[model samples]
Target: MSELATHETSAASFALSAEQEELRSRARALVEREGFAERSLEWEQTGEFPWANVKALAGEGLLATTIPVEHGGNGGSWMEGALVLEEIARACWVTAMASLGEIGVQSQALAAYGSDEVRAKYLPQIASGDLICSVCITEEQAGSDIFSMSTIATDDPDSGEVVVNGGKALISRGDVAGLFVVYVRWSQDPGMRPIGAVLIPRDTPGLTIDEGRETLGGEKLYALSFDTCRIPASYVLARENGFKKMLTAFNGQRCLNAAISVGLAQGAQDAAVAYVKQRVQGGKALAEHQGIQWMIADNEIEIQSARQLVWRAAAAASGGFPNRHDAAIAKVVSNEMALRVTDRVVQLFGGHGWLKEFPAERFLRWARYGPLGGGTPQIQRTAIAREVLK
Candidate 1:
């Protein structure tokens, strides 16, 4: 963001504009029409990518709304992305998770800092939903502590290219991504200045992608290994002082993560509401039970609170990433709120919630992924404290 842009007043209104509402409606319709809710169970069971839903998103023009308009996208803001993601997640967490790379931090980093050659090569395909990029940031020693990452991108004296060595664990989209935006130590410079990033094509030699453990949300995580992978110098997104740039992108991701969490919690609530209305207990409907009513009330309270926070954070950014402080606060609130709300939904379902055959248990499992993905609630709290102290 430019100095002038930074000074612009952030819109605090939580109400969506006509365009934003239209986007939300489109996403909601797409998910329901395509039966993503039903298909989510199959995805968890088969472990297959939801290719049909991806295409459906593309058809509805929701696939790459976050990328710059010049790059074949609508150049929508994070708020726009949030509206879409939340609706999608409300129906299927798996599809929402799959859409992250294209509409998330990885795309933002690549679009903001990548060389024209790299962005021009990948952004168009991503906007078209024909491609997805796995962001490689987490290493064995680094998850939230990205500065502790040992991945190195050294200039090759002989080949006049960049040679990368080190690995990332628990990366999404590795098995199917066509491109990689990898964060690495770019120089011997002390502190965070040396932490930069590079772009490596998925097919680059010595770049290996291997399957790893499945996540609670039923998405497969993968491990990335770079064994002296050599790439053109043009692939360098930043050589130094890129940490701030990446973080700006991450703030937006945090907002979106919160938005999805809000949606997941609401989805579970939706299921619980329908079930309680129909299921009879003792002599009356479960909805009439005081205990169930109180649980429902609490779920609504948490969901609405998280939604408002997410909207504020997301709306803070006009055409760029949101304020870091706002983003962190929203993420932590939504992450914990979703966990509580989803758990209550499971309990409301009684024995049916515990069975894998039901949706309530699955919603709880999906909510577990909220804090674990963008950053843990602990990490977000630390960030919040640092902001306040500063």
Candidate 2:
């Protein structure tokens, strides 16, 4: 396919306005200059959350890219947010995981469901990256089935608090998140509506954050447990209709995941191309070899295709409301595309690719996480099927 053929027309049409472009450029320059070029490896080896890098991102206003300017955000569109994530992902995948999760969820949740006072209180600090929030939707038994969640939020008549119970698994940025948008079932009405969401500060009583696990990607995963954790009644995002509210924010999360995968695919392809042009065998650079050339070409084709899917989803999202059908399709396609492209990069490099000395192995590892996290590939397909059939 031609490069022009791959250009995302819809995305190109609603291209980031001049102001958005300026933000992207400025962010790109900062990451290139100040980001951890080599220390990412060390961070990964140590299984650390890369707080210093995240602090740098906050200083640059990336955390606020999607929030409105009135709320102290950079006030960029979802497309611009995607551009920012792409650049950050290119620099360090771990940082992208942390920054994107916070911005994506905060923008969607605060914009749609937050009460005026809620927005006024949290949006500014969150945009400034001074506050980091994580969505607590996936529970121990039910990963994607919101209706099947077992976490409980009981109303305490005496204290006028909602007492929370149960746990969340594999939560990204779990340990370090300063705020949590928790999904829980009302004990008085577990079957009445299935589940509800509550926004709780990290310091809420009876809340425990266990050490994060070692996931396939360098994700800092945490398991959260609530033992009669009491949050003010005002902490409830919306009493009975919390599932709908969580879904609203979830749409943006899926789109952001797609964007990150697209960036990872592109980064792997670029690295492979550079490596091919320099690594010679049989008296000629690997780029001259038919086998290597074919691999590089295929990677390029898939990367661009993935990029279009991502941009299309971003364009739809930027338009005030994203088409969930398109977003699901984009997530599935981009996740699969990244897996293919990164695996090919690993193949092209032969033995060297398997070694940590080269980043291909790391890219391949992180690419696998794309499908597992943010709803599995199986869940995505089911969602797309439901939307298409409906």
Candidate 3:
């Protein structure tokens, strides 16, 4: 066999343990019981975060599964976490996104870098879904180029605090987050270490949450502004090499993001298949048509391919931080694959796909974010190329 084939065979040999499978089964059951397909529309209309679902996931031990056992988590691997996210996303992208905050990059960052006191206080609450955390990295001018971020956090020696100033836009779950992991430039001097992240509470003085911006996916994206917001110096995550640490943790986010994309595509495909099998056209079901079969086949092929890429990336990062190059490649492929698959699903549904009465259109809308969030496809490709060239 060739090298690529051997790699695929080896990867295929890897299987989930019984415990992981049980976790996946429980998560799937919860999503089915919740009937998120119907409720997702309600949440979109009302612009709510679906706290009930969050609590439900927490009760099932699905939230923050990747957090270490020493820190009140299940001590699960990244693969297990991705599996949970996939099932949740298959139900509703909104709930999936909300769950990501608890189990994705921000939570990992706190677990990996937060002081012992900070971890003891917050990690349990996060794993229990009693608290929500938001990652504040994308600024008005620094969506793709994070180093260009203008937010600054300066330390005060006398007060033993840090004064934070600047704003973040397009932050997911920012409006409802109890904790914010805000990234900022720590120094003005050119040679000094410039980037760092600090924990800021929602009720911190001088911090303001602006009106929510409606994105293509209908999730409420908020802008957070910090005007001389002073937080205790002890809240600092990594003062010197904070940006590097954050970037490393973000590889986990990319893997989970890919899982969400794959799940959304799978959900859209499942909905389309169900619809086509029942809907009669010219005295035959839509599924009986060759054109429809071709579309369905194409979607299935891409979905399976995308899923393998996600699993590979997740596995690579199971023991420690994710392999940056693999994570970037998986993110780019899965994100774009979801867009293509969801678009085909919409087309397969014909007029009903465009109508809000069905879920296909919503899947298409949700898939659009896959490329934009967790670093754009262009950014992922750039990073991948850089790694390859080096």
Candidate 4:
């Protein structure tokens, strides 16, 4: 508990401790020094992976924050990881997303559930930035409804291997990842009991990655086809009944996703503030006008509120993964909050906000990712409602 930076305000405010502040500062400095903010959109435009951003974050020990220290990582709490994500996102949403591919759901599932052989072989490499992981979950029928997912994995007892066949859509980092954390169904049953996950290295014989589709954030989403992709049986991360466990893993993911949303909104607000104070309207700085001031005030209020929700989700995970309820509410609030805040910032920037050269549009695009990335706000609301109904 002491590791988390708690505040005096209502015991809910997520105030930064000296160490957390330094960690946040370290992430910000790395982004600034690398010119990540300036070159943030280059990855999408050039269709290149942000390897430099990945390497820089990996070099600074930020990429390995979610993995346990025993695995050659920082063993930081969810809060620490959220802090790093928020700061990096504030500067460059692209870099922050790249960082998430390392420090987010796939890394978490592999670290928390992978077999000893799998963990030993990959965790060190993952911590060192020598390997990257992509989580394969969504499919044509399976974005929010896991029951509709068609990806399947089966045991081949005689071969000492597991075989997988099915396709995944909208997979992030598929082009660059060395490993894939695939969500699969072990049985045709119509319930969570049949759900499980497995790990397949990128070089596996039967796996094929399609040319990616460019996204609003400039990162590409890929389609993956596993034509009887087979790997050692040891590659299984979770067997039957694993969906419940992985849901726990995803709780942290929702928090980090929310953290990134908060960052994008805050970044937009920051940009708006600088612009408003300088850009004149009616012979006066925009900041001098009461209307502009209200916008700024509204942005701050929303940003602060979203940050606290994200932090609460992160901090509550100290006991382990956050309970689904907290993660759901936080995710819904933060995701929608980002849309409102960034939209306001875009309005504040007026004409410049529509241009690619300005950070405003980038932040806006980045903010759009939050609600869809972890889980849609609708899905989160359903989860929240489930808790409320109970």
Candidate 5:
């Protein structure tokens, strides 16, 4: 038997801890109570940020689980955060992405590398959902190639401020973010240490947030232009080794991104199963068809397998340092798995699947984000190959 098959037969192979299970249950209940499915459609159509949903999640202590307790967080493990994301994404991928931004990548970087003053000022607000943080890394010329980014942040010794000038594309929730952790080329000198990160407030001068750009999922995404934007020197995260630090924080994000993919696939599977059991054709329920049964069976197997990979990466990340290679592998598999599962679910639903009211089509659209965001499947594959070859 395959390793995945053997593990599935074991009772404890995919079991969550009691606390983790409770967290999942509560998060699921909250999403249901908020009418996430209905709201997700509304938000998608309107292109509005879900502030009320974010506040409700914060009230449930589901916003900043990975931040330390002293920083107004619950001090939860990465596994717990991933569990919450999975439950939330099962209901609404947009809201799940928002939660990931607040708690996963940008927030983790600030907590780990931000100055004490920066942390004290922003972390609590983030935990409470008063402020949303966005990470600015992808530029017009540097989608997957971080080193090719042309956005530069020059230090002014006389002015005691950093002048940032560049544009970032495809930034999630850019319109709603109160703060942004922007990655830029800090120096023109020849060296790998020329990159740096800085925090820029949304209202800072010379910072322009463009109109929202429509994606396959119809979520609110924007491009930012910083034309000689200036912020205090203290806002500088790291003048050197900024890229490495940012990448380290991004490993945790990759895990959460994988969890989102798994959750979305699971959601699609559940909807398909429920529909098949109720919809009858040829004087019999759709679920009674052997071909339909095979489709459902395949979905279950793939979802379980992808979920295990997500959990493994999250578990590895619970330690101080995340395993980059593990994160890359999990992300590549879960992302592709989500696209496949959602497509299968759409097939299972037949003509009704294409309708917006059924949610299969919506899930399919959102599933496209998995392979493209956080990191592309090709990029993850390349990273994994490099690690293994070394």
Candidate 6:
């Protein structure tokens, strides 16, 4: 194991190496420089994707970390990716969301499964933040159940093309994504199998993206409709293996979505702690109160547990270890852990937490949205059960 991992067990308080220390400082500086603290309020009010900050992150090599250096990327590991996402989320959750779409799921898809031509065409653009992308799954009828997707793609024998039809709902970055990794059911295949994915350009004919709607998490999402969208035969990524490829992408995102929640919950905890120090209660500091002190202690415990679970999950994936079951458990616990922590922070703040002036309410909203995004807590438990019993 590397020195970082060796020292991480007993007391994570060990000093960072010269290089690791430099990266952490740089990452922290970037967030502060980008007005990440203020960006959340702006995104909440405007409901617009933070492109400028994302491009800046690209400039910082944050977006390029995971893609291999051979593909014009920095070739960092999942641990680095998690650190970047956490720091970025500390400043602006919306930026983290937008970045997660490109840096996490989209990059992984291109790196692992894309054809040589597709990788050559897209990976550099993705790393440089020149072209933003989004995963096109989660249809109107198929939120968590991928098996129920109605979107269908048919192969044309005459021209060797694939025609796509159906709508993708609540697609993050959908309205502005230059490229989309679209999942579709292969109509020609047996068993109504979900077996096709293609890279669809935004400029393609018969592809229209409606304006994105505002979500409670201050997310910008769109309903993407493909009416006989024609894609070159070369664009089929995985061909008859669509389900596996899509699951790969979803697994990455599910872990990532949980990380974002961890950051938001930590942010809420930080704000609450600061408030308790300054805001007096009963003529004494709120931090001194036994009840408030217990709440603070509980927040620390839950936050640590949640963060460790996320790190373990990230590390397992990076190390190519068996991580699916652990990833699901981490995602579920972190999701609910964050929910409870943030809700408790709000309670600690009394009336101020309920107001927009404080971030507790926002964090609470985001924590609630977490479980529903990747998959519900119930779905996660079912997945865990299948593995444990097997």
TM-score per candidate, chains pooled: 0.94, 0.92, 0.95, 0.95, 0.95, 0.92
Which ranges in model 5 have alpha carbons more than 4 Å from their true place?
Answer: 1-14, 189-191
- Comparing 2 and 6 on lDDT, the stronger one: 6
- Against the reference, the lDDT scores of all candidates come to 0.85, 0.77, 0.86, 0.84, 0.86, 0.79
Question: What lDDT score goes with residue 85 in model 3?
Answer: 96
Clashing pairs in 2: none
- lDDT of predicted model 3: 0.86
Per-residue lDDT over 146-260 for candidate 4, one digit per residue giving the tens place of the 0 to 100 score = 7788889999989989999999999988888999989999988888888888998999999999999988878889999999999998899888999899888888889888888
Estimate candidate 6's alpha-carbon lDDT, on a 0 to 1 scale. Answer: 0.79
Model 5 weakest 10-residue run by lDDT: 1-10
Off by over 4 Å in 1: 1-13, 188-190
| Candidate 1 whole-model C-alpha lDDT, 0 to 1 | 0.85
Runs with alpha carbons beyond 4 Å of true place in candidate 6: 1-21, 188-192, 319-322
Q: What is the lDDT of candidate 2?
A: 0.77
RMSD of each: 5.3, 3.0, 4.0, 3.0, 3.3, 3.2
Model 1 C-alpha lDDT per residue in residues 271-379, reported as the tens digit of each score: 9999999999898999998988999999987887888898899888878789998999999999899999989999999999999877899889998898898878898
* Cα lDDT tens digits for candidate 2, 274-306: 898999899999999998999888987786677
Deviation in angstroms for 76 in model 4? 0.4
Top-down TM-score ranking? 4, 5, 3, 1, 6, 2
Task: Give the per-residue lDDT of model 6 (tens digit) for 62-122.
Answer: 8887787887887765656766787777667888888886657778877777888888888
Distance from true location, Cα of 192 in model 3, Å: 10
lDDT of 1 at 141: 81
CA displacement after TM-score superposition, residue 282 of candidate 2 (Å): 0.7
**TM-score, cand. 5:** 0.95
Task: Please provide, for model 5 over 1-390, each residue's C-alpha lDDT reduced to its tens digit, 9 standing for 90 to 100.
Answer: 234323543533556776776777788888989888779888788888888899999998889677778989988888888888988898899899888977687888888888899999999999999999999889888888888888889888899889999899989988789999998887766445788889999999999999878877878678999999999988988777667877888898898899999889988988998999999999999999999999999998888888888888888775554688988988998999999999999999899998998889999999999988888989999999999999
